[model samples]
Target: MESSLVLEKYAEKNRFYREITEKILSGKTLNFEEALRLYQEGDFYFLGTLANVVKENLHQKRYYYTINRHINYTNVCTTNCKFCGYHKKPGEKGGYTYQVEEIIETLKSTPELKEVHIVGGVNPELPYEYYVELIRKVRENFPSLRIRAFTCVEIDWLSKISKKPVEEVLTELKQAGLNSLPGGGAEVFSERLHKELYPKKIGYQRWLEIAKTAHRLGIPTNATLLFGHLETDEEIINHLLTLREAQEETKGFYCFIPLAFIPEGNELSYLPGPSALKILKTIAISRIILSNFPHIKAYWVFLGVKLAQIALLWGADHFHGTVIEEKISQSMRKDTVVHLSKEEIERLIQEIGGEPVEI
Candidate 1:
């Protein structure tokens, strides 16, 4: 459909969206039914306008990016989820795990880094002490760097290995200086897909419980959805709504990152990935639907830099930092660079007329 005709045609047929738009413009919140209706009936331009209204009201022209780095401590994992192309078995030809000293050395080499985003495979061989010591050592060395490490999946695995409850494990990690939760290991929330992809991993409800526990203990976290692969629109809406309800309850989710499933080295590589339009639509709809969620991030690493810049206007307020080294995506598709410089990220934000915000 033509962009100009989308709003006009919908305005004539459906009074619902028009009414919702008025509410949105008037700074009123849309209820669940209204949001679901918008997802079903709202046109591209209409959704974009409503989303932009929210984005501008919250942040104006200023977009957020981070001066950070990503460190994948180990690629060895036991779960072996079908959608993953990065995990390797222990003692496998390509598997590697970084020691605490090695991680500290790497952190020392990189200066002016605001955050260190760390995630790795759920390797059972790595002792629980390794993770705790890693966080303690990093925090001890760099008191200022925000350590956003581990996913709910890792936490679940940690609890199992350490024979501790989820809350107890989280408490120990927080005591050892774990700052926040990185959004990973949450591929989708649909039960059917969840089992097919990651049967051995923790269930969706378990993931949410772990997150809620972290929130209760004062650890803020980012939420994510891996879309564009065997999931339906209803499943997507359900996933978003689930996160929305959780956010409303705990107020711990800081951002919602929509991950476009990259089909390359995974078992689902036979399927095609999402299109650019779908990606933008997901980003824009996220802003409109997740009303309580404060920020939506357009991760340049997964979506690519150019598409990420375009997503800023599509209602994404956060650009994931200068990921100095990203391995998970590269493992799937080995054609891209492993790191992006801070200046390059700033220039990309500037080109889109967004103020580069670093924190």
Candidate 2:
């Protein structure tokens, strides 16, 4: 069918769809109601088309990946959030914490590494100095590598344990060679979800505060939303809008990643995870709503390689890097591959008619 015929049919069937399409193409912003309606009732194909237009307008045909590795320094956590499958209680049988030298040794083995993502559970056993020393040692060993470490949740825990303010903790870490913060721990922005799902972690207000503080200190960060769980459509839209408003203020978010919930080994194992349509719809909606976000990522670790390829056409511009190893998702699913070679990544992007650019 011709593109014109499709538009005509849609326009005749749904006037609001045509109106919103024109509104988006005219370079106008989507308000809360418009974005929410699109998320709830918009046609799947048309939604992807509109989101792809927005993506191309911002990033052209370029898709980005990075040569990075993830370091799960420790799994012993006290928080024990219900949705997490990676955390182990202190002194649990499988728990481990890497010494600073051990982390350096792991980094030394990876070739062509550009970034090291360091995140772990909220382990009460480790002293505050250990966190600083880890960053310092990573910087000492790999001076040129970008060190994206910690989430707002971990930072809040550090502040409490060290008897320092959040700003002070961030400043100390920055001085010790932290480049930026990752966008985990922001499960959703609703207070109801915060209390229901991750009451032990920091709430949304504190997360935003810590993120904006990092931005003010010249550290850029990414933002994320964990969907396909117990969240409603309104909660999802509100989460994106909150991030959009925060981005308007600080301009610090590097990317927005919509993480699909994997309900394998967690407490929510009874529930089925998000379907392919929901995943693609969420990605497209994220790109449409988060206009200030420079990139939208199709994190293959959660979405899988093939579906992630389809996501590239539906609004995502970043295929999250050659993560040498990621333990969080691996703990939940035994089939999760820990590494993807740069060649494999580029081939996957190119096969989908995308130009792979390594950042």
Best by TM-score: 2
Kindly provide the TM-score of model 1 when superposed on the true structure, using C-alpha atoms.
Answer: 0.94
* Per-prediction TM-score to the true structure, in the order listed: 0.94, 0.97
lDDT of 1 by residue, 1-359 (tens): 53335545656777886687667667666666777777767677788866776787888888887878889999999887888899998888999999889999999999898999999988977999999999999999999889999999999999999999989998988898899998787778889988888898888898999999999999998899999888887778888888988998999999899999999999999989999988988888888778788899998888988898888888899988888898999999887566778788888889977788887
lDDT of each candidate versus the true structure = 0.86, 0.92
TM-score of 2: 0.97
Question: What overall lDDT, based on C-alpha atoms, would model 1 receive against the true structure?
Answer: 0.86
Superposed model 1: Cα runs more than 4 Å off: 1-14, 26-37
Report clash pairs, candidate 2: none
